[model samples]
Target: MALTGETSTQLALRDPDIRLMLRVRDDDAEAFAELVELYHHRLVTVMHHLVGNAEEAEDLAQEVFLRVYRGRKKYHPKAKFSTWLYTIANNLALNILRTRQRKPTIPLNVRDSGPLGPRPAEQLVLDRHAQPEDRIQQQELAAVVKQALETLNERQRIAVVLNKFEDMNYAEIAEVMGLTTKAVKSLLSRARDNLRVVLQDYIHMNEPGQERKDEG
Candidate 1:
């Protein structure tokens, strides 16, 4: 059966796990397992982007789920399930990045590859075919962007991940991160400025005669 939005919402509303989660507040092992199955892959994907290593990302994702399972009794519906899930993910990723002694090695232009999904290069080519120089510049630009993201303060990085990648608005981001809307805006502003500076040369080189636009 295809998982359409309506069907997914209905499943969520009627999901034994969600209902189990309500029971989890009272301590239910079965419900916890259900939540695990539902969120594990998503959590792993988020962690991989933040932590930059599949093995570590998987470990971190497991830890997040473990925390949720252990803290089930304390679960509250102050936000959507996804927001709460991502909040835990964001915190864990930041902590991992903080405690590590070695800085993460930012990868250059590595395209996404999946068994069932279109390859990253294929997707890019389909969107826009470019000359060899353009391709090189694009890869360099992506590398700079990734490096710049690594340099953001933990909170700022989380904000950008949510805002840009997750397409969350300020209110949603604030709710997920437990910050005020104004604070979320400020964090994103600082992150954008930093990225602009870090990627200035790439932007200028790519745009040719155009002045670089301010990052929103």
Candidate 2:
């Protein structure tokens, strides 16, 4: 007999950190810190990749934990603890992105701190192998790839970040994004298309020609 998706998810909720969250719901302050310790780096990593700003991601990660603690009493183990933690993270990332959309601000960390995706800076580097003169600086390459990622809409960007950085599958991405798995599929499909379009020129490693020509 196959376990349904919901049942599988419910069963997965029995992981250690979910129990820790359950303890948090019972006023266990130590359990809460333990949860923070467990997820802080991972949360920061995902948020940083999502937003393209390391400092802001760190601040948002703290807020996510703080919000989780404040909502502890209402916490329920309906999903994996990581999933719930990332939900808080996802919301914060979205809000920050929205705020950034309204007012442009300089990003704190733009160096190799962008999307870790199926499409990544390293892949771009690989594509440049045939053109030794076209190799871009690592930072420049990351920034270019990041720019391509920014071409995606918010939903697609988030989906790509989770799928690539967090190693989450369609089901988990769907759970975090509050969408159906089918919707996640469509989002990824579209995101890849947009990335290919935005990155078409750079995909051939020809972008460095401009910088080299400038120096010449």
Candidate 3:
């Protein structure tokens, strides 16, 4: 059968594992393990952005999952599954930031050499007619832009990450962060403005010359 939104949502809502989660409310062990497998990595990635360290992020993520398992019996479907999951992530991340008493830092110079590599700007330089020197300058400019994003407040940072990286729309971000759509838009607008200012030099420097345009 073709999946309709209602049907798909119902299936997830009444999923065997979610049903198992219902069982977990009654104190089922196996059901909890199933929940763990489903959300662990996703939770970790969200937390890593909030906490800014892989190890502490992983630890905090585990705690959030554990809270879910413990609270399963009381689980209610007031929101979508992902929404509820992100609510947990957001709360945990906020708590971590508050307790640690450290300002958020975005590491501009850090190269993405890991299994999952850098942002597109870092990985791809679209200089059609520029020489190698120009490409090097563009890469440095991209790094500065990335760093500026890091300096934004936590809400703005999260909003940018979800909207840009995860492709979430305004409503989805509002749901995830418990903000209004207007608020989400404001956050993104501010972030974009900050990024534009931070990368102004790069933008001006990289503008296509009239010769290049004429050729096209």
Candidate 4:
């Protein structure tokens, strides 16, 4: 069962990472490293998907830690440790995207504009087919899906990534994005719609191929 607000707050207070963060507030260097060790890969992976580049994602993840360290003295358990961490990440990513928006060098959003209104294809490979994909095919499909993600507006991209990649629910995504759950739902709806259109050919390929007829 999901925890209630009070229970969640209480749990957050008791969480090991929260404890570690508390220690960090006391200038415990080891606590800082522990927090990084715990969240580094997860943050990097999520940021990588968001930014569509490993190097940028790594830089962003490090920045998150730096901000966390600097703000440790003011740390308060407003939410779970993970939720707080993601909030920082969300802010940094928005800044990067906004900067990109003003730059002529960066490619802007690549939305799928067509007649296809959305169907759920949040994770392209998983949603497109029921049969299991072999390693190579899955990798190829993942690359396509990653490209599809870049097409979304930044908010939708963040929402979809949190929902699909992190397995976060609408509420969690809302918290991370600082939006309402309803807003998160709308974002994900639009994102999935876009993904469906972009990956339409691949999805169709996953279906049983039509048999050839020998017409005489």
Order of all candidates by TM-score, from best down to worst? 4, 2, 1, 3
Write candidate 3's Cα lDDT for 1-216 as tens digits: 112355534755655554556666778787778777877877787677656678987898888888887667677555456566677777777666666646434443455544465643433333323443456454555455555665567787778777775567888888888889999899999988866755544565556551233344
List the candidate numbers ranked by lDDT, top first: 4, 2, 1, 3
> Which segments of candidate 1 are over 4 A away from where they belong?
1-20, 26-30, 101-142, 204-216
Clashing pairs in 4: 118-193
TM-score of each: 0.64, 0.75, 0.64, 0.75
How accurate locally is residue 160 in candidate 4, as Cα lDDT from 0 to 100? 82
On lDDT, the leading prediction is 4
Better of 2 and 3 by lDDT: 2
Off by over 4 Å in 2: 1-13, 107-135, 204-216
The C-alpha stretches of model 3 lying farther than 4 A from their native spots are: 1-20, 101-146, 200-216
**Over the full model, what C-alpha lDDT does candidate 3 score relative to the true structure?**
0.66
- lDDT (Cα, 0-100) at 181 in candidate 3: 93
Model 4 worst lDDT run, 10 consecutive residues: 112-121
How many clashes show up per model? 0, 0, 1, 1
Return the number of clashes found in candidate 4.
1
Cα RMSD, each candidate: 11.7, 9.1, 9.7, 9.1
Q: Which parts of model 4 have CA positions greater than 4 angstroms off?
A: 1-9, 104-140, 205-216
